[model samples]
Target: MMRSPANKIPADGEPELPGVPHVHVASVVSALATLDAEKAGLDALAQAMAGPLGAAFDVAVATIHNSHGRVIVTGMGKSGHVARKIAATLASTGTPAHYVHPAEASHGDLGMITSDDVIVALSWSGETVELRDIVEYSRRFDVPLIAFTSNPESALASSASVVLNLPVAQEACPLGLAPTTSTVMQLALGDALAVALLQSRGFTALDFRQLHPGGKLGASLKFVRDVMRKGDAVPVVASGTNMGGALVEMSAKGLGCVGVVDGAGALVGIVTDGDLRRHMAHDLTTRTVDDIMTPAPRTVRPDQLASEALNILNSRKITALLVVDGTVPVGALHIHDLLLTGLA
Candidate 1:
């Protein structure tokens, strides 16, 4: 096996030492070093699974989604932590997943396992004693057992209905005793599985929104309707109104824009800060809304995606969009709203 530099140092009187270990810089270097090994390990795993695991992974995916069954992921030690994250990602995506500790599964938790559920076991060595009981139970009941392990010849692989061999190149640990590259590759592969299955099932951002209801993700999927100014809060003026009246409405609303409605109360045009600048040459006292307002300016549906609306605003070089239902004005959504929601 080839090895890379253990540490980088500058030539000095004694020896310019490497970035201090366990510090921020060293931590980054260690993470990158392990990432390089993980990439190589994944490449090898891809080659090994080209024929053997391609179909097996498909079966595991199909078992969970196509059959109205859940994927029960389990592991011990470091593998268990990775399994928990994998389960969390899978559940947040389109796949229904949950993690079960191997020891717990052997107890009354075994009842949680059903023929409809697929049991996925993760053990780099594939010989965790805590996994024995659940593996036996899965086999006896004929429940699908999908195993991820570096050792295909181990007991875990032998008993699994489908085995995905995770062949890590090497650990990043200098002692080579800690699980480093192995767990990273396993976790990344788990992500790959979730993304692939998500594509297969046509999962959308809306589906993701369902799972992530907190934080920035929830904010990303928020619609324009969620934060738009509605009812009289929307700044508007009649087409017969002078630019001074329109400016008053726009100034009071503090949006730097106003929607001009016709006598029928339908949106006719819009005026913006840009219009104010371009039409400053004209007298505002006598000019009607039409003389300066941009007619039928880009209007968005109140129900449009905030991300999509942000794109439109950015692409058009505009700061605000009129929310109109057909010809009737409903509300106004602005770039600032998207900024407030973190989508801008």
Candidate 2:
């Protein structure tokens, strides 16, 4: 920790902190220091607020789980940003949540809220004029309300069903008038509530997959069939077929390989580009597909995860795998498909 210079007095006004060093190594160390400080502050705040925050969280989870509606978070200014992030986190983590700016809550947004919903209001001063209507509306409509405010006795806190006192010490800002520390404390408490409820509900990665079924995260959740090429797209030929016919089919499939199937069309053996190279000296035009096909093809089930398929492909150094249903090749998935879907 750097000590305050004796010449740097409060009466001398705000003292400027040193600029981060220009070199990459020095900049990394300074950035790490800031990260460490933020992490410590968040941990400390979480500990300091455990009792009240836990109680409030329990109340919120019980209210939402038992009720037929959602959770509405309302705040103003910097607290509003934290409230929005909290709402997003809660919703993504299995709890239904939404943020309603207090000012907007008065402009017909209150109508969106139902009695079944619980309102979590955040206000550092606990006396924002903009929040009065929604606060009063919650009271009048009998909707359960939980308030977060620095003042336990403020109008907003006093109007709620339960009040979580925010006892942040001082802002990181030298002026001590900004919302820095207070916002951090609120954000930490919000995360605690969200995570506690998340763990309590036994939320799973599969559950999260359902909520975010788009983009990279969604691709990571996909099954083998999601990226597999099905039907005629699969490179395959029946056993005992001539190598000339197999090469023709493999070339048509354009996947660099072919699966040799039996009468059931299920995969029995695989022939790859490497196999062709290995048999280059031999006249494949005279050999049967079974004579060249490597028996017992590597395969994956349609129900298996694509990530597992990727691991298999990487380990085997194969370009593609046959997706089988009880030895029947329903689809084929290439490594390029995984890369296209951002799962590679």
Candidate 3:
């Protein structure tokens, strides 16, 4: 028995047999072909969205947006997996949505959907046997039914109130049996619906933060006031204070900088390590803080997002930002603070 190239592992620096592709090379080719096929499918989807699908998509978005209840997303098999992700995206983006497996819908999950709720079903063929119960339930209750399918003539599409007819395209799978390009199209369409609804509702970043309060995204959306060190934690010196006193305040506060406040308690300048280095001289300690400070140093408003403050810190190449109310220094934020908050 002769070992084929696939069964025979090539040793280091050994050439592959003539007219035979290495396993890795064949895999790369397959991967590239899959990508190309998916890309083609996406192109077709984009074209459909611009053409016949536009009116139906708008109607679907409006139907979901105007609904007083949550969106019930349902599908079978690979489409079920995509439906779950779509539901999550919709929920996170301010639209109430949840997935119900078609198989489970027949087994008593049908009660999970209400008459007020809208049903968004995903089925490439639109004839999934498991989806029949959901379709019937939607029809019986007069619940709004939105269908995603390539076959507009299929049972699901014929019964749906809004049929988003997907463009039939070649599958990424070489055998053309697996749900590859079709699932991608469904997922992309689901995202489009979610985003359209989200925009229609005027959902803000603060709203998003409220929904996602425990992650890095939450930290990034936090207000500067929420992260800044307030009150006595901020290092400060009187406008006319000498560099020696300013240095003491900076060292005591450990923020590497001291804010110089005028008589009215408004921030006028900042004395940083860089300023001290630039003003280095025999009389440096005796110099007035004004002489060693940088006037109108970059500052962030307390109401600004921490992510914006991070941007300023990175662009200015500085480690600290003074949080201000008008010209009054109320707080200080260090790069370390942002890092601790997981914003960096």
Best by lDDT: 3
- Winner on TM-score between 2 and 3 is 3
Best by TM-score: 3
**Models sorted by TM-score, best on top:** 3, 1, 2
**Superposed Cα RMSD, model 2:** 6.2
Each model's lDDT comes to 0.83, 0.83, 0.93
Query: Which run of 10 residues does model 1 get worst, by summed lDDT?
Result: 8-17
How many residue pairs collide in each prediction?
0, 0, 0
Off by over 4 Å in 3: 1-23
TM-scores of the models, in the order given: 0.86, 0.82, 0.93
User: RMSD, model 3, all Cα superposed?
Assistant: 3.7
Please provide, for model 3 over 158-197, each residue's C-alpha lDDT reduced to its tens digit, 9 standing for 90 to 100.
9999999999999999899999999999999999999999
Candidates, ranked, lDDT: 3, 1, 2
